[model samples]
Each structure stands twice: as structure tokens, then as C-alpha cells.
Target: MSAIKDDAKIAVSVVVHACGRIDLLDRCLDALVRQQFHPRRYDIIVVDDEPNHNTLHLVAGWRTRTLDRGPRLSYVANPGPGGPPAALNRGWRVARAPIVAFTRDDVVPEPGWLAAGLAACDDRTEVVCGRVQTLIAPHPADAQPGAHALEAADFTSASCFLRKPVLERLGGFDERFDIRGSDADMYFRLLEHGIAIAQAPVALALHPVGPAPWGQSLLRVRHEEFDALLYKKHPALYRQKVEPSPAWDNYVVAGVLLLALVSALLGMDIMAALAFGAWLLLTARRCAHSLRGAAHTPSHVAEMVVTSALLPLLTVFWRLAGAVRYRVRFA
Candidate 1:
């Protein structure tokens, strides 16, 4: 890491959190390099969660290429505990500017993104939330088996700007909610502290939804563990903003299937048949809901059926696991 010169006059430090997706990172960097903001007033920092030769080389190449013409580009390796929050912390802590802008490697900002974000940051504003447009598959049939769009929330870290001093005062992000929910937690904390958050509608970024393999939704169930932590930390805000009620449908589905299994083991053939029929009905409903606007290919339909039948059980298990681990009365 080279030292930032004393007279560089950097105003905004754009922190991009990346994993090993060099292809996406390459596009993100390309967009940043062409920002409408003054090139010398802002710098780009790429924080790699899992830094390897490919990421290092990509950042190094961008740094060399943009050294004279554009904002200075640098790479930082995330220290310990891997997650977006940790990577963001690493990026801003080493930033040369007082204002920090956050975005992901998969997102491509418009040319005026930085300029608009900076414009919204007045003396009274401690944070600025930018707009993000998500691009998904052109057609349902072309969508991948487990494809999903990224959530373009009101105050996601993917397109927000924050004052470095305010971040330091708030202790940055809570690393315990490692997989997710940290961004909303931070936003709620800012409100608690009476810090002003402004919205910049003109600062736009494009997040392209990508393909995923089969069973991707099942793999995402682990994110529920952090929901317990978020709720424990901010019950009122979590209820108001996140979820007002538990997923009652998931519980119903799981309970019906369990009842069917127990009745069969007890040799109650009639009761087992009824419970199994109910379970099938509920599972079919879920599968139909999932396939509403999704790909309707035969394989996609099969995937939805199989995953929908098992998702309720998995979701309930993870929710309970989170509640137990966090010692919260969440469900």
C-alpha cells in the first residue's frame, strides 16, 4: 500500500467490495474510471474479500493505467472475518478522503453517480443514499434455473455515501451480522444518533442479475441466521422496516409434512393420507407462486417443485437456529 500524498486533495473515496469475480470487477472499474466527477478529487479502492493473484493483478493493472489520467486506484486485502461489511471497513479505514462511497463489484455506476452523490452531501448530511436499477434476464425462459435479482433497497451499501468521521463515531458495521443485515443496522443506528441521511435520486447504478446453479435458494437459507441478530439489536426498527410478522406459511408447510410423516409411522393410514394431501397442496401453491414470472421450462419447473417442497423445512430450521444462536424470540 503506497502512502497517500499530503496534497492529493481527494474528496471522495469510492470503496468497491469484491470477491474473486474479476470479470464483474473489471466492468465496475471501467465505469468508475469514466466518472463525471473530477478525476483527481476522488479515488477508487477495491477491497477484495478473498484476494488472489487474479484480483491483485486486476487492481494493479487498473492502478497503473489510471495513475495519471483518472482517480488513483488501489487494492486492499480484507483482514480476517470475511464479509462485505468487513471488506468495506477495510476499504474506508485506509481511504484518503473524508467522504466514502460504497458499491459492489457487480454494480456499474453511471458517469454522474459520484458527482450526484457528492452534490447531495451537505454539511448537515452524514449519509447519502443513491438509486440502483437492477437488470434481470430479458425473458423468463432465458433466466437461469435459480436466478434472482439483487435487492435494491433504500439504503443499501451497494450505492451509498457516508462521511468517514460519522462512520468512525458509529463504529462502522457490526461484523457479527456477517452475511447480511449489517447495512440496514447501520442505517437505523444513524437515525438513532440523529444523523441526517439524504437521498440522491440522480446518482444511479446498474446491478445486473446473474445466473445461478440449482439449489441456490437452499444455499441462501444461511442468511436467515443474521436476521435473528438484526432483530435482537433493533426490535422496533426491525419490525417496522424488515418483517412485521414471521413467515407463517413456512411453518404451516413444515408442520403439515411432519404430521404426515408421524401419522404414517403410527399406521393411521387415513389421517396420513389427508395430511400428505394437504402438504402436497401447500407445496404446489408455493411452487406455483415461485414460477409466476420465472422461467417456465420443464427443468425449471422441476427445480421449483423440488426446492419449494423442501424450502419450508429448511427456512424454518434456519430461523430457529438463528433464534437459538442469538437468544432472541424470533420466528
Candidate 2:
């Protein structure tokens, strides 16, 4: 990758949509300041999706220690917690650069990131997605526990870069999605518009992936709901991106758990026992499959055992919530 020479105009704008993870955001900011690329080549625009001014003020506070003179950084707010797409839209409005790349507040880019990313975008490809691994020292095998790391693909996470022409061509991220799958949707749209999406495995970024969320919270419901909305937009395609064994296994376990609960309350002990046995059986298979890749510690095994019991339930609850919310009528 070519190093930034004598002061090129800031042709790239790195749009980061951040909320609530101040520590991780600070880490990204630190990495940005440490970037070897000339500050004039790119500008960092952070959109504070959170309502609190503290998130933006924190970025301002970092300048005291960061003392970054390279890229000009600015923070903006969205219209009433409109989520990632909304935040990015706000960021895009103020963007003066010809290229728009995306990253999460939790991502710490490597030194050659900006240079490599821009170079990858010059011709043929309109969407450039780089690699991201867990930020935690001994990172989890998967960014989300129980799942595996994303394979090198034609697409990456929301952390990819979009050329200005292509960004304008696709008309920006769809605001209909509050979050989730919106990144994938954008990539597919790029393809529809004949824009190539390529993977730059050498361009590494550290993602501060947190503990996987499990349970029946409103967030869980909303995530699934948004996914359903996404599927509605591209039914056949969603099946391709988010399908295969692990998901179907999850679907079956959900049915089994519901059966056990309802059957036990109806005082059908035999039926309840069978339902419970089915759930345990499915959980064992899932845990075994997920734990197969390496040597397991007590904590890992314990976590697997515990999460197995609830993961399926959480997944189903979310999907069902999504389907209902989006009025998804699956065949």
C-alpha cells in the first residue's frame, strides 16, 4: 500500500456510528490518531446515535490526549435515535470526501487501513470490505459466542467502504431498517447496480465484540423484527445469507421448549418428559458442534452448557417477534 505523500485532499470520510460504548469508542479513536496515513487524506466523522451529548463530548475530550493532527474529526447527532442508518445519513450529509467508508465505534483499524482501503476501491470494486477480528486479548472464537467468525466473503460487516459514486447510486442506506442486515442489504443493492464488492483480508480491524445477548428483551425482539423486515425486502436472498444447519437446529429447539412448557402446565407428565428430553438432546448436539474446534476450558464448557439451554429460545423469540412485526408471511 502506498503511504500518503505530500498532503492529498481529504478524499475519504470514515463514518462511524457509535452509541453507549465509550471505552471501545476511545480505543477506535486512539487507533485513528495512530494511523500512519496522512491526516489530510481522510476525515473521521463520528455520528452520535445516542441522545446524550456526552458521547460526542467524549470525542472532544479525547483530543486532549490524542493530539491528532492528521485527519479532521467531527461529531454529529441524528434525528431522535434513528439508529445506525440514520446516524450514517447524518454523517454523509456533512461528508466532504468522495469516498465514504463505515466502521463501528468498537472497531480499531490497523495502521495501513485507510491506505489499503482506498487503494482497494480505485477500480472495478465499489464496495470494499476488510477483515475484522475480536478486540479482546483472548478473543472469543466467534464475535458472537456459539457462532463462528464470518468467513471471507463477497461482503463484510458495516465496517466496509463505499465509494461516493456508488453510495449516491444506491441512494444510501435504507432508513426503514433500524439496524441489523442493513449492511447486507446495501451490499446486495450495490451488486444490483453492478458495483463489485471485494474482500481485503489484509486490511485488519479489531472489533470490540461483547458477550452475546440472550433472553427475551425488547432488543432481542427488535433485532429479529428488523431481520424479518429485511427478509421481506429480499426473501430468497435472506434465506441464502442467514441459513443452513445452526439456524434450523435453533428452530427445532424452539418448538421443543414450547411444547415442554405448555405440556407440563397441562399436567401431561409423559408428554412433558418427552419434550424436555428433546430439548436436552438438541442442546447437546448444538454444544458439541460449537465446541468441536478446540480444547475446551471449564468456563467454555460451562458457558456452552448454560447458553445451550437458552440460546435456541432467545433466537426463536427474536425471529418470531421479527416476523410478527414485519408481517412476514413465510411459505
Candidate 3:
């Protein structure tokens, strides 16, 4: 790429939705400072969802430091009670770029980030998305690639971008979803509105995913319930797109735990011992998977273990929250 081409490329803005985790946000911002894309081609906008004044000051400091270099950096505070979607919409409104990219405050984009997404765009494309890779210690030999192929979709929220026009039409992400399932919730709504979504393999972000926060699992289960709403809206597509989960696995886990509880109470030592051992083995594998690699201090290990134990509950809660919050608004 010529220096002039790099300097003249269309501007792209990254809208980050951040709350209390200033440390993670800092890392994300730090990565932006090092983007291989020309400094003139993009800007970073942060929406501090924290109600405190300190966040605003921090954002100001970042901008002041960045101004000495290139592309303008800006920050906006959400007017409503803080939530991810709400914060994102707030940032989207003031974005000055023809393309607006959505990324969590915790994601670090790859070097070719700007060129990758901009190259993927064309007059006919409405939205584009990149891949995400988890940052973990002793990373697995096999990991799922997050960069997805582009296609006509309802909507996309996972490390993605939208044309200014489509974003204006969809009114940004559905702010009603506080946490869980909000991405897919908006994605489904976008499909309903006839939006285009394409995936770019070259654009990528490194995002962290590990252990769950204490008892936050129920919200995840409740969140998944919104998937049913999609079914209600497009029965055939939902059926064709999503597969039936292995319900038998859950049943076995539940039954084994119940049997172990009954056996122990009845002093059936052999059966209780075997069932308890089986349960521990299964849980251990999950724990192992979650804790594999990067640097983990003793405290990190404790947190990861706790999160692993709590994730199943948290995921269930998340999906359930989705189902309850978006009860059959299908028209």
C-alpha cells in the first residue's frame, strides 16, 4: 500500500462499550495505538458506562495523548443507566465515519484491522464482521475461528462493522438486552429488517473468554430463551439453522447427581462413591479446558476454578433471561 493510499483511506471508528473494567479497556486502547493500519485512517471512541467522573478524565487523558499522533480520539458517556447495548448506541450516534465498528472494551484488534475490514467493503455490502480468538495461556492446539463468512443476515454484533446507512435504519443494537444474547438478538432483528451481513477472514480480534462471574449463570440461560423468539418469528429458518442440543447429556448429569445424593443418604457406599467420582471427572475436564494457558497466578487459578463451577448455572440463567425479556414479540 502506498503511503498516500494509507493516508487517504476512508475513516473507520471503533465504538467501545466499557463499564467498570478500566484495566481491560486500557489494554484494548493500548492495542489500538499500535494498529498497523495508518494512524490517519481510523479513530477510537469509548463510551464510559461508569457513572463516575473518573472515567471521563481517563478518556480525556487518552485523547490528549493520542492527539499528539494522528486520527482523533473521543469519548462519550451514556445518558441512560449503563448497559452494553445502551452504551454502544450512545457512541454510534456521534460517530463521524462512514463505517462504524463495534467491539467490546476487552478486544484487541489484529494489525491489519483497518485494511482488512475496509478491503472487505464494497458499494453493495451493508455490514462486515471479523474473527475472534481467545487469549489463554498454553492455548489449545485447536480453537474455533471467529472470522465468519459474510451473507445476508438479520444482524451481527460479534466484532463486526456496519455501513452508516444500515445502522441508521436498524437504530443500532437493541438496548433492551442488558448482557446475554443481545448480539444475536440484534442479529435476528437485523435479518427481519432485511440487512446484509458478510464476514471477512482477514479482520480479527483477540478477546478473552474464561471462567464465569459468580452466580451470573441464570441470566445466560434466560438470554438463550430469546433464541426461541427467533423461532417464533421464522419457524422454518430457526429449525433449519439451529440444531437440537444433546438433551440426553444434561439428563444423565442430573440423574447421576440425584442418584449419588440418594445413595449416600441410604448408606449405599459403592454406588455413591462411583457416581461422585464420575461427576468429579466430568467437572475436572471442563476446569482443565477453561484454565489452559497464559499467566495465571494463584488467585487467577482460584477465580478460574470458581468460574468453571459456576458457568453452567450462569449460562442457563443468561438464556432464561433472554427468553423472559423478549417474550414473543414476533409479528
Candidate 4:
């Protein structure tokens, strides 16, 4: 790849959404300083969602220390501690470049990430989506790959480059997605508008899956609410791209448990035993396949196994709630 000329007109503004994880923000900012692209050719904007002044103070102090050779850095405070979508919209509003890139505080972009993303952009490209690879560190002692061990997603806000005009025309991210699914919603809108999205395989970002509480899966069950809304807004596209098959897994899991409970209540011991056995067998098989390379240690594997068993039940329950709230049957 050729080096970007000093006089080149292409400059990118990177917007990072940081919500109280100052350490991760520090690492992300430090990584940006090492990018192969010229420091003057790119700018970094960190949007802090923390309501308190601590995050702003931390960034202010860190900004003074980074004036030597790093890209220009700045921070924007959210109106309140809302969510990433709101923070992102605020950051991009003041962006001064033709290319507006998005990433998260927890993500660290590769040194060539910016260069590759810009190189992938042209008159025909409306959006440039980089690859996101999940880093699963099962144990503290294990060596982490500087790059991704496995690629997790083809596109995400974790790393992306979009033309400033298109973003402005679309009026930035939809705040309706207060927390999750906003990234997907943005892309769906762009596609609907006949915009051409390109892929930059070399523009990589590492997404580390941090350790979490056992109830984390239950919290994620809330995605069903967003899914219901997403489907309601764009039924054909959502069904075509997001979920081609019906939510049979949820129904099947719930059906087995319901059958078992009914049989037990009716004093049909043999039927109850068969229904319970079937549910266990199905859950075990699915868990084993899904956790193949994701779980690295015994503890990690155990956590995943237990979470998998509970996730389906939680999914069905929340799906019902979402259907009622949205007044649309997901099935």
C-alpha cells in the first residue's frame, strides 16, 4: 500500500463512545496514536456518557499529555448518561472531516485500520464496514493474540467508516434504539436508501468479551424488545436479513417444559419423564456446538453451559413480553 501524501485531501474523524470505562478509553486513545495514518490526517473524538464530571476530568488531563505527536483529541459530554447511540450522534455532529469513523471504548483498532478504511472509500462507497473479531480470554495466564483469533462480525459500529454527507442526510443515529441494535438499524436504513456499503477486510478491530455475571444472559434477553421493534419497522428486510427461520427454537424449548409441567400436574409420571429428558438432550446438544471454540477454560465452559440452559427460557419469556408490548406476534 502507498503512503498517504501530506497534501492528500482525505482525513477521517474517529468518534469513540466511552461510558465510564476510563482504562479502556485510555488504551483506545493510546492505540490511536500509533496508527499508520498521519496524525494530522485523522482526529479522535471521545463522547463520554457518564453524568458525573470524573470522566470529563480524566479526558481533560489525558488530552494535555497527548499533544506531542498523537492525532488531535477532544471530548464531548452527553446531556446525561443516556446510551451509546446518543453519544455517537453528539460526537459526529461536530465532526470536521468528510469521513466519520465509529468505534467503541473497549475496541482497539489495528495500526493500519484507518488507512485501509479510507482506501476502501471512493465516490461509489457510501459506507465502509470493517471486520470485528471477538477476543475470548478464558484465563488470565493465556497469551492473547495481537490480532483476532476468530472473526465475529462482518459489520458493526465497533469499527466503521461512513461518508459524512450520508450520515447528515440520515440525521445521524436513531435515538429510539436507546441502547442496543442501533448500529444494525443505521445500516438497515442506509441500505434502504440505496446506499452502497463496502467492506474493508484489513481494517480490523478487536472486541474483547469481558467476564460477566451469570445473569448476563438474562439481561441480553432484552434484545427481543428491539427485535420486535426492528421487525415492525422493516418487516421484509428484517425477516430476510436478520431471522430467515421462525423463532422455533424458543417455541420448542418452551413447549417441552410446558408439556413436562402439565404431565407432572396430571400425575402422568412416564410422560413427564420423557418430556424432561427431551429438553435436557436438546439443550445439551445445542450448547456443545455453540461453545466449541468460544470457551477456553473449564470455568468458562461451565458458565457458558449453565447460561445456555437458562437463555432459551429467558428468551421465550421476554419474547412474549415484547410481543405484548409491541402488539405484534414475533412467531
Candidate 5:
């Protein structure tokens, strides 16, 4: 990677979407300040997405520590709590650079991360995505507790750089995505417009594993609605990249459990026993599969076990809800 020469121009705008988790956001800000790129060669824009958010104070605390003639750091509050896509678009709107890069508040980028991504950008490149390695926290209750190997990934906003023109032409991220899969949708649109999406393997970022509350995973069911939206917008590409499979497992589990409950109500003890036993077997298999590469503390194991059992049902319910909402016939 090439180091930024003295008197380099600020050509890159690194935008991070921040909500809560002041600690994580602070870490991300620290990493950005430490980037090898000359401070003047890049700027850091953090958009606070939380309603009545106080992240500006956090940014204020770090403001005085700005590098001597390094990248300019600023914070902006989102118009309202419209989610990541909104915060991203808001930041990019005010970005002064030709290249607009994005990462989450929880990510800690390597010193060379920006340089690697910048190197990948050229006249023909419209977007560049870097690699992200998951750093599992030692805590058992961490929501995303696991190790991640570096690998090629589809377009992800988690560690991505996009040309300013490309973003303007493509209309930025669709706010309908709300939170999840917004990057994929944007990249898909980019492909449709014949824009080039490049990969920068050397631009590495670390995603630390952290705990999520019990209902958080279940909330992802809303992605089904976005999935339906994606399919509606890009049928052929969606089919190629993410279609042809239904959540049959969810239906199976739901059906078996319903039958078991009905049988028990009717005094069909043998039938209920067999049905419940089958459900248990399926749940056990799911638990084992999920626990395979995860940190296996007692708390983690128990959390996985309970969530696994609920996942299929929740998944099916959400898919159906999404299908109804989007009228896409997803499942």
C-alpha cells in the first residue's frame, strides 16, 4: 500500500453511520484517526441516527484531538431516525470528496484499510468492498460470538467505497430497506446500471462480536419484507443470487407442533408423543448445527438452543408476512 505523501489532497470521504453504543463508536473513531492516509487526504463523517441522539457530544470530545492537518472529522444528526440508509445518504449529501466510503460504528479498520480501498478505485470502478473479519468477544452472551475468516463477499456497506457520481446516479440506498440488506440492494442496482463493483481484499476491517438482546434476532424477520421488495425490484438477479428456496423447514416445524398440540388436546397420547419427539429431534439438530462454530459457553449454548427452536417458526411467520405485504409470493 502506498503511503499518503505530504500535502495530499482530501479526496476521500469516510462516512460512518452511528446510532447508540457510544463505546463502539468511540473505538471506530479512534481507528479512523489512526489510518495511515494523510489526515488531509481523507475526512471522517459520522451521522448520528438515533432519535434525540447525543453522539454529537461524543464527537465533540474527540474534536480537539484531530490530527495536525489530518482529515477533518464532523458529525451530523440524521433528519430523523430513518435508519442506516438514511444516515448514509445524509452524510454523503454533504461529502466533499469524489470517493465516499462507508463502515459501521462497530467496525475497527486496519491502518491500511483506506489506502487499499483507494488503490482499488479508478475511472472504471464505481464501488469497492473490503474484507471484514469477525472478532468474537470472549463473553458468552455476545450476540455475534464467532470467528470469521477473510473471504470474498458480495457488495456490503459494512466496508465499502463508492464513487460520488455513481451514488448520485443510482439515487443512494433505498430507505425501504430500513436496516438489513440495503447494501445488496444498492449493489444490485449498480450492476443493473452497468457500474463496476470492485473487491479490495487488502482493505481489512474487524467486526467485534457483541451481545444482542433476546428479541433482536427475531426482529430480523422484518428483512423478509425487504427481501420481497428486492425480488420485486430485481426479479432475475434476485432469482440468480437468492431465490428458488422456500422456508419449508419453518412450515414443517410449525405443522408438527400444531399437530402435537391438537393430538394432546384430543387425548391421543401416542400420536402427541411421537410428534413431539420428532420436533425435539429437529430442534436438537438445529442446535447442534448453530453451535458448531460458535463460542460454547453454557449461556451461549442455552441461548442458541432456545433461539433455534423459535427461529423456524418466526422465519415462516415473517416470510408469510412479507409475502403478504409485498405481494411477491416469496414462500
Candidate 6:
């Protein structure tokens, strides 16, 4: 732990949005505290969405232990509507520095991450997108079945920096994109506003893949709800940058499955059989495609098979739900 002069000016404020994952938050705080950047030049703020005894205790302990070690650390409980976007908004709003860096509680930044990100920022740069390296490995024995690794993009919420003025001007993240697509929405908005986004390849962070429960893929279909909202907000940008085309396979699967049920009710046995067969074939193909490069254990294979059968309906349902909720014509 290094000491900083009381009068030293802070240049960057790192904002980490956390939930109840105290373990991950602890590791993230440790990494931020050990940054190679000047202790007084940066500070760390953790915004807990679901504040609890454990989370408060962990942050309190860090504040006390780092009292004189520089790089001032603090905690803030998310005030209102619960979500990453809301928590992040609360964080940057209270940030003391002109530049605000965003990262997740699960991400462990490199020692030079802060310095690299700040170095890449210049007078014209409004945002800094950092490089994120995802650490993947086989699931442990005690890990839940069908667990998959997380992926990163060139511009993701996991690691990025933004100027406080730009954030305030843009009114921060849209709370409507509560689950997913909020980051992409914000990025697209930045582009629309002609805000400069500089890439900081040297500002690397390690995002370790964690375990997930069974049917996680199916559960994630709900993310499509937010995708529909994003599409409504930026149709052209969503098509160009987010998704060039819709998931035709999923549409086909959902359509045929619905047709099969309708045909059965009409007593058209032949049509019902044909539609059901098509659904099975499509689902099988999807399952095999999803298994590519994935774990081949019996439990994992079974999980994929079950999720593949249900994902089409679930995905379409959520997408439609979002479209209706957001008043969009997106399919």
C-alpha cells in the first residue's frame, strides 16, 4: 500500500457496480487498490445494488485498511430502481474525478490498467474502451451443470471509461435497459452524438468465467427483451452494429412448433406429424450446433438438449414481449 499526499488531485474515479456477490467484490477491490497508477491520481467507488450486512462489512473493512494506503476507496448503496445501469448512474454521479471508469465486480483489472486507460484519453476523447481478456477453464466438479464461459466485445460495460461531463450530458444509462443491451445502447448513443471513443488496448482486465446453473442458456433468453428495446431505440444502429439479422432458426423452430399444435387441434394428423417432425429436426440441429466446442459430459449434453427444445419458444416469447412493451415492430 502506497501513501498519497492529502492535497494530491484525483484524475480518475473507478466505479464498480456490485450486487450481493461479496466474494467477487472483494477480489475486484483488491485489484483496484493495487493499481500501478499513482495512488492519489485515482479513487474507487463500489455501488451495491442489493446492499446487505456482508457487503457493508467488506467495504467498511477495505476503507479502514486503506485509510492511509492512498487511492481512496468508498462505498455507496444504490438509491432507487435496481439494476446495473441505475447502480452505475449513481456511481458516476457521485464520482469526484472528471474521468469515470466503469467495471464490474467480477472483473480483476491489471496493475497498469488505470494508467493505460488514462494515458489513452486526450482532450478530444470522450470515452475509453479497454481490452478485456476472459479467463476460461473447465467447470469444477462442484460447479453447476451446463455452465458456460462469458464473452467480451471490443466495447463492453465490463471495462470502459467515460468523461463525467459526457455522461451527465447524455443523462447516463437508460434505466429501461435494466438487464442487457444498456451498454450497447449507450455506445450507439455516443456514436450518434459524435462523441469520440478511444480504444485502450493496454488497459487490460481479466474476467474469469464463473459457474452457472442448468438451463442457463434458456434463462438468458430473457435478455432478448432488452434487445428488442434497444432495437426500438436505435433500429439502424441495432441492425448494423448489434445484430445484422434476426435469428431465423429460432423463428422457424417457434413457427413449426406452433403449427404442429394447431394442426393437432384441427385433427389433421398428417400435417401435425410433419410439423412435429420438422420441429424435432430443427431442435436437434440447434442442440448440436450449441454443443460445438462445449463440454460433452452427459449432464451438459442433457442440459443442452432440454434447453435447445425450449429456447426457441422462450426467445421468441421474450422478443415479442419486449416488442409489445417497447412498442416496436421488431420480430
Q: Using lDDT as the measure, which candidate wins?
A: 1
What value does the lDDT take at residue 45 in candidate 3?
85
Spell out the clash pairs found in candidate 2: 39-70, 39-71, 225-322
Q: Which one wins by TM-score: 2 or 6?
A: 6
Which residue runs does candidate 5 get wrong by more than 4 Å? 1-8, 51-54, 79-81, 137-142, 145-152, 211-216, 262-271, 293-297
TM-score of 4: 0.83
lDDT string for model 3 (1-331, tens) is 6745643464788888888677788877887778787777788888888755766777777888888675567878776866788888888888777898877776787777667877887777777877776664343221211122112223344478887777788787666564433666566666677777677867777776544443343233444555655555556555555534423443454466668889999999999999978766766776677667623566556655665555554544444454566574321
Residue lDDT tens for model 2, 1-331? 2233422477788888888778878888778767777766777888888757677788777654445465667778775647787788788777778788788786788988777887788677777888776544343532253222333344654457877777676677888775556666776677666767777777777666555533223234346556777777877667776652235666778888889999999999999999999898889997787677633877667666776677677777777777777788632
lDDT of 1 by residue, 1-331 (tens): 2354632578999999999999999999999999997788899999999979899999999999988888888889986789988988898899889999999998999999999999999988989999888776754432343223234465888899999999999989888875358888898898889999999989999888776666677777778888998989889999888889998989999999999999999999999999999999999998888888877878888888988888899989989999999999999
What is the number of backbone collisions in each predicted candidate, taken in the order shown? 0, 3, 39, 0, 4, 0
- Lowest-lDDT window of 10 residues in candidate 2? 142-151
- All candidates: CA RMSD (Å): 2.4, 4.9, 6.9, 5.2, 4.3, 3.3
Please report the TM-score between candidate 5 and the true structure: 0.87
| Of candidates 2 and 1, the better by TM-score | 1
Model-by-model lDDT, in order?
Answer: 0.86, 0.70, 0.66, 0.78, 0.80, 0.84
Provide TM-scores for the models.
Answer: 0.94, 0.80, 0.68, 0.83, 0.87, 0.93
Instruction: Please give, for residues 129-184, the per-residue lDDT of candidate 5 as tens digits.
Output: 89898776554442444224223347777799998888898888898786556876
Off by over 4 Å in 2: 1-8, 61-68, 135-143, 146-153, 208-222, 244-246, 261-268, 287-306
Model 1 superposed RMSD (Cα):
2.4
Task: State in Å the error of residue 266, model 2.
Answer: 5.3
Cα lDDT tens digits, model 4, 163-265, are 8899899998877674446776887888889998999989988777666654465566667777777777778878887788668887898799889999999
TM-score for predicted model 2 compared with the true structure: 0.80
**lDDT comparison, 2 vs 3, better candidate:** 2
Query: Model 5: which ten-residue window has the lowest total lDDT?
Result: 142-151
